[model samples]
Structures are given as structure tokens and as C-alpha cells.
Target: MPMLTDTIKEKLSSIQGLVFTEINNYPCIEVPKEKILEVAKKLRDECEIDQIRDVVGVDRFTKNDRFECIYNLYSHPLKIRIFLRVKLDSKNPEVESLCPVWSGANWMEREVYDMFGIIFLSHTDLRRIYMMDEYQYYPLRKDYPLMGLPGAVQLPKK
Candidate 1:
């Protein structure tokens, strides 16, 4: 629940192209997809952000960058939580996996990939969590119909 300290801010500022901002008073870092792995490593190794609380994907259909990946990170020792966000291209939204830094990220990354169709490069067990493997559409996407596409997924007969 703690806010980012001046020391942590200074450390984060050294990383080129990383924009440090706040949303609702919570520190958020917007990093380029190419630098996400490197920045994540720095955060874990240098900033002591040891855990990723959650991974979320956002569909920005109207924006030029149609996808976004957000990582909620926590520093247990400091009792601080921060957000890392990456914008992705609409045609092929992809980003490097952070499983190497934190093993717990494996499942979280997979969930994002499954729901958003955002490929997590180098994720060992990247697969669907809720939808079946043959499911074609990403239900969470803005373009998806509220009632869902008929025949998109086959349900067991009751």
C-alpha cells in the first residue's frame, strides 16, 4: 500500500524510454515492449519488486495501439505496489515473458494470452485457461458480441 519512494523514483528514471507516472496516486511505469523484460529484471533485481500480483490485458480498440499489458508488481519488503504497462500493436500483440524472473508469472502470462490473444514470447506453457484450444475468438475483446458468437465454443449437452 506504500507509494514509491524518491530513491526508487531515481532508480527508475535512469532507464531510458521508461515513463514514470501515477494513476490514482499509485506509481505506474509505462515501458516499451522491447524493453519490458530488461525493465522487469531491473525492477526485481534493483528495486526489490519480488512479486507480480497480477497481469491484466486491455483492449483499446479505438487507439492506434490496440492492446495493452499491465503487470501489477509488489515489493514485499517495502510493502509497495507498482504497475508496469506496455502498449502493443493491434495486428500482432506480443511481448517477452517474465517467467524467468518470477516463476509465478507463467500462469498469469498464459491467462493474458488466452483472453487477449496477446502472445507472450518464450512462455513455456502458454495455453488457454478458460476457453478451449479451438476457440477462435477472444471473448474479452471489445469487438466480441455480448451474447458471444454462436458455435464459437461447444458446450457439453445437459
Candidate 2:
């Protein structure tokens, strides 16, 4: 099978509201948060991207946007990988949920929400998957305390 080529990249870039770019040598496309669901549906149906491999969040504390959410997708038949990124502001970071596109995204989106405090708008059951319901801080943030915060649960006494 042929690998993802320039022609394919150009086709993706040609999508009305998407930008093809790269990050750390990996080909990436930035999709406006509002358009993520639409673009994701197209990629799944047209490109045969069968799986959402992972969803990750980066905390760029110093940057004005402050966070980036990345979606890693794989096309099983074509043997290709694509990365979709969405930049979000630090305060009240939120993006449309992908659960409607791929059911597997339910847990992945919840994980991102748990660690990064980003809301998946319209998610049927958005909640903390790992952290406690009352935990106040996003532990993965660059500004979170290294020693853990006061009043939150501490390590169990040995």
C-alpha cells in the first residue's frame, strides 16, 4: 500500500476550514475546535480512518493559547496516521466532543478532561475518569504543585 503522500496532504489542506501543518516532524492538521466534529466525520467516512488511537493534551503555560489538544487517528486499510490538533485557551478550555464521531472517544475525551480540565462540549457523561470528583486542580498542568496541593488527599500513611 502507498504511504500518505503530498497529494493526500494537499487534499486534507484543501478542506475548507483546515490547515495542514507539522509538529516535531509529524504531519499534523489544525482544526478549529468548533469544526473538529465535522472534520472528524469526514476523515472517518472519506479517508477510512477507522480508529482514534489516542487523544493528548499539551500544557503550554507561557503561550497565549495555553493548551493544545491532539487527536491521533489511524487508517487501518491505508496504513496511515494523521494528527489533528486544536488550540485552546487556558481559562475554560473546551472543545466539541468527538464521541459522536467515534464511540471510542468517550473514554479518551474523559481522560483529557480529567487531566487537563478541558470540557468536551455535549459529551453525554463528561466526568473525571481518574481524578476524584472534588479534586480542584488539573495535576498535569505546568503550574500544578509538584508536592500536591493542600487539603486534597495525600499519599496513604504507611
Against the true structure, whose lDDT is highest? 1
What C-alpha lDDT do the candidate models reach, one value each?
0.88, 0.84
How many steric clashes between backbone atoms does each model show? 0, 0
lDDT of 1 by residue, 14-69 (tens): 67898877778788889999999988998899889999989999998966789999
lDDT of 2 by residue, 8-44 (tens): 5545664677787776666788888888888888788
Which portions of model 1 show Cα errors greater than 4 Å? Answer: 1-3, 155-158
Minimum summed lDDT over a 10-residue window in model 1 is located at: 1-10
How does residue 35 of candidate 1 score in lDDT? 93
